[model samples]
Target: MNAIELSHVSTAKPVLLGDSLTELEVMRDVSLSVPEGEILALIGPSGSGKSTLLRMINRMEDPTSGRIFLFGSDIANLDVKELRRRVGMVSQTPALLPGDVADNIAYGPNLRGEPCNPGDYLEHVGLERELLRRPASALSVGQQQRMCIARALANHPDVLLLDEPTSALDRTASRNIVELILRLNEKLGLTVIIVTHVMEHAQALATRVAMLVGGSLIEQGPAVDFFESPATETGRKFLRGELAEDGR
Candidate 1:
């Protein structure tokens, strides 16, 4: 079963409002499907709409045209709260609650009147159970990110969306998070979609890769094929590191 899908999804934001509105299309004809238990990395220069497209998944933003499906259901029709729970998201930087580690992890479940143990998810994210009581602010950047992951998992999500999850981590922390992501995909069968600017990190974790630029999908394919022998010049440039993020 497909965990998530976007069919000709397009998003436009109003740039000018007057007698006639001028809108900037941030994403256009973006169609992709994330298979169950697979990892898809979305890579692109900045302002290419990578983050815009990611936000569309849980309805943090909506498409002006086309459709987005989550686990075979139209996300637009699903309850916003429930849709987010089923498809969790973590951003580039950790956003922990103003409390202890356990409180951060249990925040989601507590909202739904469910019980959760910080230990159950800590190990999954390479965190120690003993740190459960530490104040969120006291933990290292990496530990904070893991706490964010644990919090997302507390919701029992089927799909996990990460946007540049390791961009702020040290080399070692980044690698550890990558390993944790793989373990989650394997053990929990979670469908993972990550938006990242770092090509090496994407190469390490993604089964398939999707490239977006100027609000449009340039190409997508197996990671090896996309990186080694790109079909488009733009893609080739991107892979060769000639194109910096932001397409400059």
Candidate 2:
């Protein structure tokens, strides 16, 4: 069964100046399902609405029309805070609080009324327990990113949303994050959706690939099929580096 489902999802832009004013449609009649216990990678150009789609999944942005179901329940009717707690997000720039590492990692757990134990979570994310005493802002970018993951894990979430989680890291650090993501999935059976502009990273980690163009899904299927036999001309161009010049 699908863990998440979007039915004829469409998000429109709001009028700014006048009631008749129209904005470009961000997503149009989109429908898809993500199964439990799998990693889905979303790849697209800058204005393709990939981020918007992810945001809608977490209810950060509501859909203009249609419905979304988490498991079997309608997500639009769920409690926002409770739903967000179940679906954790990690952005490219790690947003750490002005506190020690332990505090940062403990924030989510505390908010959820769960036990805040930083040592175990930090270790789970492959960090030393001793680093818990260091200020969150003192860590290097890579370490900060790992701490962000640890913080998310502290919530014991069923799903994780990662947006270019390795974009700021060096190659070594990027590999480490990817490895850690895989390990976390194996250990916790987390359903993960990672959005990245980097094709190589998507190729390396995605169980399934969904490529978007002009705010619509161009191709979506097994990772191998999307990479080997892209359905749309836009997807084909992207794979051949013809569309890499776009600012995405």
Each model's TM-score, in the order given? 0.94, 0.93
Q: Give one digit per residue, the lDDT tens place, for model 1 in 1-248.
A: 88999999998998765677788888889999888888999988888999999899989999999999987999999999999999999999998788899999998899989988878898888888999999999999999998899999999999999999999899999989999999999999999999987788888888889999888899888888887898898898998879765565
Candidate 1 yields a Cα-based lDDT of 0.90
Top candidate by lDDT:
1
Relative to the unseen true structure, what is the C-alpha lDDT of residue 33 in candidate 1, on a scale of 0 to 100?
89
Clashing pairs in 1: 46-246
RMSD of 1: 2.3
Ten-residue segment with the worst summed lDDT in candidate 1? 239-248
lDDT of each: 0.90, 0.87
Q: Which candidate is the best by TM-score?
A: 1
Question: C-alpha displacement of 157 in model 1, angstroms?
Answer: 0.7
